[model samples]
Each structure stands twice: as C-alpha cells, then as structure tokens.
Target: MSNQHRMHGVFAVPTTPYNADGTQNLEQLAAGVEHALDTGIGGILCLGATGEALALSRDERESQVRAVVEAAAGRAPVVVGCMAYAPAEMSELIAEAAALGADAAMITPPFYGGLPPEAAIAALRIVMAASELPVMVYNNPHSTGTDLQPSHLVELLDTGSFWSVKETSGAATRVRELRAALGDEVEVFIGADGIALEGFSQGASGWVAASAWLLPEQCQRLWDLSRDGRWGEAIELWKGLGAALGQIEDNPAFISLIKAALSRRGAEQGPVRPPLPSVDTESVDALLSTIDGIEGRALHV
Candidate 1:
C-alpha cells in the first residue's frame, strides 16, 4: 500500500524515560513528547535503538507507544520502531504499534543473524507484507549489521511495501545515491545526527534525529533552514550544534548522555535502564556545555 502521508522535518527518536523503581514513567514520557510537539518537532518515534527497545519488555513497549501517541494527540505523526528478530516478530510489533495509533512503522532487517542482502530483503519483505501500517525501512548498519544499499532500497521500494527509508549508514553520499536512484518515489530521512547538514545538502528529505529529543526548537529550525534552501544559515547553525550532534552519534553511552541532558533541563528522565550504564559525569558536563554553548548562538536565519 502506498503511504498517503509524506513524512518530512525533524522526527524525534525519544528515549524511553523510566522511573527509579524501574517502571515505565508514562507521565514523564508523555510530558517530554508534549514538549517536543510544542517546540515544533515534526514527528515522534518510540522504541528506537536510542529508546533501548532491545532492552524493554513487550508490555513496556506497548505502554511507551500508547503514551507517546496519546501525548502527540494528532498534532504530529508518530512512528514506532518495529525491528525484531524475524518477520513474525516484526509483524507483531507493527500490529501492536498500529493498534496503539502510530502513523507508521520503522523496520529493519533482523540484526542478530548478520544476514546477507538477499536474505535480509526477503525477511523485510515478509514483515512489510504483514504490516497494516505504512513502513519506513530503517537502515542502521552499526546496530543492525546488514547494510541496506541504495540498490537494495530501490528494489524494496519498487515492491510498494516501503514509503520511506531512514538511511543511517553514516555516509552522506548514500543520500545522494538514494536520491539519484529513486528520485522522489520515496522519502529519505537522514538517520545519523552528525552528518545531518551534509545529508540535507545531498537531498535528504527529513532527519530522524535523536538530538531533537533535547533540542527540538533548534532541530526544527535547522530543518526549516534546509527546507527553505538557506544553506549558509543552516551550515552556521549546524556548526554550533555539531559538537552535541557528534557526541549523540559517536559516544558509546549516548542514551545515558541524552537522559542526563533531559534531566539537567528539568525533565524527569530517570537513569537509563541497566546493562546500559549511566553517562560519566565528565561526559554529561561536556554535553551540557556544548548544548549551552549552542543555545547561546542566535539562529541567524
């Protein structure tokens, strides 16, 4: 089925905030989402790698999706990360997300097996076939191991199963190649935060931005600048944001850092779930400094 909605702008991949008792903090989570919407974020994506979906229970995933969708309240589109070990598992996630009122599903090849391109394609096709909602194929090579090449994406998009792709190979050139291959047939969202400016320069239609969780207004302004062809202003804004965005994409404890930033800003984002340790004090301080420094810069656009 063709996706009727053409997603664009800053889609925030929010961290799943938890309470100290290890329960899902639905209230705090909803409040954070509400803030993102109020600050002009274009979309909400729950259960992404940034959200520690691999670490959460099925019930927790459901709760988070429900909270975010309800908090969005039709003001913006919401996409649920539905990547799983197999087609049936992914189909279950997609169904649950769709039932919870998500606008679309962001899916990837099963990460565990290191499947080759052909096998990965087959698995994704099976999952997409079972999905009731529009699917945005998520191509995160670092986390997933399987790289969805532009050619692979073209093949999949040709099937009419996917309406968009989150290209996270971390190469801005991939955006150029995908644009060259598919033209306007599908939306291409840059998934890596560090290369956002380059990706936008190369024709990425949107950004699935983790940084937006902390800096929604800044992220949205960058999107507006890029969309309006104000590269000079966008580049300058990106320069101010580069340090924070780099840390978000490059740091080993990025999720912890994100939660810490939110907590510092007075949001009730508790510690990240364990097995994922907390951000170092120094790193948190540095992130805060970078963010503070960026915030001081006037958005010259």
Candidate 2:
C-alpha cells in the first residue's frame, strides 16, 4: 500500500524498549513491530509520544526509527513520529525518518510551555516545508498544553503537506470538524484512547493508540464495531473503556504502567527509561481490577 493514502484501522505506537544502559533494544523493537503487525494493526509509528520520543536523544530517535523501518520490511507502513522543539530540529528528525525509509513522518506541536495557535501554524509550516515526505500532525493538547484548533487546523490542512492528524486531547468533535473541512482530503486519527471508539465512529479514519501497544485486537475490535454501524455496542464499550484506558496516564508512573501492561500480555521486556518508575504490584492489581470492570473483562492479564 502506498504511504500517501490515509493510514487506516488501529495504528499502534509501540514503545521503544531500552536496555539498562539506555540504548534502544533494536531486537525487541523489531519483535514489537512484528507482533503489532501480526496482531492485525494498521501502521506502526515508532518513536511517538508513547514511545517516549521526547526523552530520547536525536541519535536514539533515529535508531528507533531505523529499527522499525527495517523490521516492518514492507509488511505495513512505518511512520516515524518526528517529535522535536524547533523547526530546525523537526527538519533533522523528519529527514532522518524519510532517510530511514519510513512511509511517513509525524509531528507534535511544540511540547512543554505550549505555543500560540498562530505560532503553532507557523512552526508546522516550517516543519512541513523541510520535508518532501507526507506529514502527520500529532495533537495532544493535554501534554503539549497547546492545541490545534479545528479552524486553525483547517488552515494547516490547507497546506496539503499534512496528510493526517492523531487527535489525542479528547476533542472528539474535531474529527467531525476536520471531516467537514477537509472532506476526505486528509486523514484524521483518533489519538485519545478514551475516545478512540467514538473517534472512529465519527468519520475519523483510524486511531493511533498507546493502549493499542498491548491490546491490539481489543482496539481493533472497537474499530470494527464503529465501522460496522454497531453504535449500541460501540457506545457501551466506549463508556466503560474510557475509565480504564484513562488510568494508564494518570498514575504517577504512567509510562512504566504502560510497559508493565504490555509485559503482562506477553510483550515483556519493555522498561520505560527512568526517572519513570515501573508499575508496582499494587498498581498492577489495581489495573487488573479496572480491566475487570470492562464489558467483556476478558483482558489477558
């Protein structure tokens, strides 16, 4: 499939595994990619937010991208999440993504301390200008503290450089606004695990989920529910799933909790690079308790 088209279904941002020395575990990364692809996910976006892209040095980011690109070996599109501060940094990161033979590159607005809407639009313009490759914008206003407004995002979409957006900030309405504005001209991905099923229901092309790293089929089932016009089923799942999915981020040790969840599902060996603490056994028990509350409650752990 051409990378130029909308990345569909449940695209997973697999966590970047680290050895004790803080170097990326390429072998494990490759394994993760293969597992995600085999589990019937759509695309693999490495070095994304959930992958702790911001924490990695540029060289480390490049290594993670390279491993994902190489591991996919053309089975599915591999997009490198180009997370950086300045446009110049984005240029280098995106250039590396493209150089590594990535199918596409993703960009998050300036993280930490936020950017004004105009500043974000301008910054993204510069970033897109630097790359010939298609771009996917990442919008997680909760973490970035800056959001891509539906209107301003329309302007950014007008640039045609951005092929999609992974909307993570619980703005499910933006998917409708985006569809109304772009009309299939661009792809809109639901980035909020809490709202992913709703996002898919409301014309969102797909989801780029951190939760999907562990629950690939579960997430995919949600997508299937939305696509199949099973609104009652989808809503029932969404209303309950949101609460549990929301937990992966709220706990003090968020990333570690994510890795632990994946580990429990047999995707073991992922250790979120410290100062992020691993999920304690108590937290694990709590997570399981929450998972049990889901409709099916058939979680692997």
At residue 181, candidate 1 shows an lDDT of: 88
TM-score of each: 0.96, 0.88
- What digit string (tens of lDDT, one per residue) describes model 1 on residues 1-301? 4436787778998888878898988998888898899988899988885458889989888888988999999999999998888789899988899889999999888877788988899988888766788889988777778898988876776455577889888764899999898778688998888888888888899999988989888899888989999989888888878778887767888888899888988987888877887778888888888888887766433
Which candidate gets the maximum TM-score versus the true structure? 1
Cand. 1 TM to true fold: 0.96
Looking at candidate 2, the ten consecutive residues that score lowest on lDDT are 292-301
lDDT of 2 by residue, 1-301 (tens): 1355656778888887766776777888799888778878888877776557767887787777788888899888888877777889888877778888998888888878588978888988888866767888888888787888677777775565778878876754788887887667678888777777667768898888877776676677778888898888777766656676778756868667877866676666567765656778787777766776773554522
- The candidate scoring highest on lDDT is 1
